[model samples]
Target: MRDTALGAPNGAALPASDVSAAVGLVGLAGLLAWIAICRSFPEFVGAFDLALPAERLDGPYAALTGLIAAGLPMVLWSVFVDKVHTRDSTGLDWNKRAEGQSTRAISFTKLTGLWATWAIIAAVYCIARWYWEGNYLFAMQILGVAIVPMVVLSVPYILWLDRRMFQPRDGAWHFGAFLLAREPWDREKIIGHWRAWIIKGFFGAFMISILPGGFTQVVNADFGLLASQPGALASALIALLFVIDVQIGTVGYITTMRPLDSHIRSGNPFLAGWLAALLCYPPVNYGLMSAGGLLDYEINAPGWQHWLAGNSMLLSLWGGWMVVLTAVYAWATVAFGLRFSNLTYRGVITNGPYRFTRHPAYVAKNLFWWSASLPFLVTSGGPMEALRNVVALSLVSGIYYWRARTEEAHLLREDAKYREYHAWMAQHGVVTAPLVALGRAIGRGRGEVLQPAE
Candidate 1:
C-alpha cells in the first residue's frame, strides 16, 4: 500500500530501512553549514579588515553551491560508510573490471542511445513554449551550457561504466539497437528506456527552474522581524523547508550515476502512473489546478491567515503546524538522499517517516493544504462557493491519493523487498497498522475479506 526503497526482508517483525536516518541529516548538516557560511562570510572578512570584496554570498550561485555542499557530503557518506558502490544494485564490479576492449562495441550502441535521448529531450525543451519563458528559461540556459560538455564527456563515461557492469546490454543499448535496426532489441526495454529519460528530462528541468526562487526567499528573509509575526514567520519557515526540498530534489535528479548506486532501476511503466504525476506539474498543473484552472479551489477563500487574524494563540499554533507539515514533506525528500524522483524506482527506503506510514510526504502535504487553505471559509459568494472550494480541494487531495496508489503499484511489482515491507507494515507499522485494520473491518462489513500477501 506504500512505496518504499531498500529495506530488510519479509517477516512478522517490522523491517529496517536500508538507508540510515543519518544520511538525510548528513545532507541537512551540509546545507545548513553552507547557509551559515553564506550568512557570515562577509562579516568574517570585515572582522579581519582585509582588502577583500566583503560582500554577502546570498546570490543564486551561492544557492547552487549549497547543492554541492549538500551532495558531496552525502556522496562521501554513501561510498565510505554505506559502501553503496559495491552493492549488487549498482551493477558495478570494482574488484573485477571487465576488459574495456571487449565492451567497446556495446558501449558504442549505448552511447548512441544515450546521446539520442538527450537530443530528443533538448528538442522537446525547444518546442515547449514555457521553457523559453519565466524560470524555465534559467533551466534552458543551464542545460544549453551543459549540452556540449555532456555530449563530449558521455563517450568516456559510458565506455568506462559499461566495462565494469556485470551485464552491460542495458535498456539504453536495447534502445540503440532498435534505432539502428541492426540488432535484436527487447520491446519492453526500449519502452523502459524512453520512460526513464522522460521522467529525467521533464522533472529535471522543473526542479532546476524552481531551485532559485525559494532559496532567494530564504536567503533574503529578515528573520528577526519575521519572528514577531506568526504569519510571516510561518511563511519564511515554509519557504526555507521548500528551499531544502528543491535543492535536495535537484541533486536527486542530476546524480543518477551507477557509481553512487542511485541510478533509476525503472520508471513506472504504467500510463496511469505517468498521467497521475504529470497532472501535478507545469502546463498540466496550470491547466488543472492554477488560479483560473478547472479545479481551482481558492476562488473566494480568504485562507487560514485571514480568518485567524488577531487570535494570537490560534495563529501561532496554526502556523507552527503548517511548518511541521512542510518540514515532514521536506524530510521525505531528504530521506531519499540521492534517489528522489517522480515515477521511478531506484530502491526501497523504509527509514525516516516511512517507518510510520508509507506516504508521509503526501499525507503531510495534503493535511497542510487543508489547514492552510481553509477552503470552507470564503470571503464572498455563499454556501455554494464554500462547497465548491471544499470539493475542489478534496479532489486535489484525491489526486495525491491517486499518485500514492500508482506509486505503490509500481513498486510492488518491481521489488520483492517492497512486498515484504508492505506486508510487515500492514501488520506492524505504527500508522499503517491502524489504517489496515480499519480497511479490513470495512471489507468485512461487506462480506469481503482481504487476502494476505503470498
Candidate 2:
C-alpha cells in the first residue's frame, strides 16, 4: 500500500506509474481535439476562396470551439497533475528532480510530436487542395502553409544550434560576444589573425544587411503584394530589389567599418555618429517607402504610390554611389595600412577623400538620402514630390554640419598631430576650406565646439 503522508520519512508513496494512465488519456484526447479543429477550420479550406464551400460558417465556428475546449482542458490537466505530483512528493517540487531533466525531456518530446503532427496535416492539406481545386491552388496552399511557420521556427532553431555548436565549455567568448567586441589596434596582429576577422565581418554583414531585407521581402511577398494577374511577378521583383539593397548595404558598411574602427574608437563622436547613421539609415528609409505604399506594385499610377516609387529610385541611386565609395575606401585602408602617416594624425584619418573635403563620406551619405527621395518625386510626377525632397535634403545637411564639428574637436585632443593636419589642410586649400570654416562658424555659434564627452 502507498503511504498517504506527504514527504514521509520512509519512502512509501506509489511511483509515477500510478498516475501515468490517466495523464496519457487526457493528453491523447486534447491532441485529437486540436487536430480535429485544425483539420476542419474554414481558414484552412477557404484560404484561396476559389470555391464557395457548402456551410460557410460551420468550419470556422467548429474550429474556434474545438480550439478553446482542447486548449483549456490540456492546460488545466497539466497544472493539476503538476500540483498533485508536488503534493505527493512531500512539498518537494517534482519539477526540481533530476536537475529538471525530466521536465525538459517531456517538453522536447511534446514539441517534436506537435511539429511532426503539423507537418503531416500540411501534407494532407496540400493533397486535398490539389484534388479539389487543381495544381495552382495546391501550390498556393503549400506556400501559405509553409512560409510563415518556417520563418518563425528558424529564429529559435538558429539560437539553439548556435548554443549547442559554437558555445565553448571553456571561458572563450561566444560567437555573438566576439562579433560585438571592438577590433584591436595592431594592424599586423589583425591581418595575421585573418580567421577571426573573416568570421566577425561575415556575421556582422549578414546580420546588418541580408537578414532584415530578406525577411521583409519574404513577409511582403507572402501577404502584402496581391496580384491582379495569377502570377505575383511585380511583387517578386520589388522584393528581390529589397534583398539586394540589404546585401549591398551590409557589405558596404562592414568594409567601411573595418577601416574606420581605429579612428572611430578614438572618441570621435562625429565619425562614430556618422558611421552609425549610415548603418541605420537604409533600413529606416526602406521601411518608410514600404509604409508609404511605394513598394506596392498593385496600387499604381497615382498619389502616394507615385511619390513612394520616385523617392525609392532616387534613394537607390544614392545608395549605390555610397556603396561604391565605401568599398573603395575600405580597400585602400586595408591595402595601405599605416602607410598614410600624414593622413593619420593622432590616429585620426584625414587623407584620400578627407584631403578633398573634411567629410566626403558625409556628403555621399547625404546625397544618397536625397537620392532616395527622388524616386518618390519621379513616380508622383508632381510639384509636391519636389517640395518633400527639399525638406529632406535640408534636414540631412543641417545634421551633417552639426556632427562634423563634434568629430573634429574629438580628434584634436590626441595632441599636435590632428591640429597640424588641420592647419596644413587650411593653408593649402587643397579641399574647400570655406566649407570647413563655415561649419566651424556654425558650430561655434551653437556653443557646440567644446562640449565634453559624456
Best by TM-score, which number?
1
Task: Name the regions of candidate 2 deviating beyond 4 angstroms.
Answer: 1-265, 268-346, 368-377, 437-454
Clashes of each: 7, 16
lDDT of 2 by residue, 31-92 (tens): 34543433344565666564655322322223223323433443354346533323332223
Q: What is the C-alpha lDDT profile of model 1 across 1-454, one tens digit per residue? A: 2323324443545556656667778888999888877777778898999787887677667877888988998889998998889888898888877888899999999988888889889999999899999988878888899899999999999989988898899999998888888899999998888888999999999988887787777777889998899998999999989889888888899999999989999999788888888999997899689886888888898788999999988999999999999999999999999888999999999988888788888989899989999999998999999999999999998888888888989998998778777877776778777887787788799898542211
Best by lDDT: 1
User: TM-scores across all candidates?
Assistant: 0.94, 0.32
Residues forming the 10-long window of minimal summed lDDT in candidate 2: 256-265
lDDT of 2 at 93: 29
RMSD values for the candidates in order, in angstroms, are: 3.3, 25.7
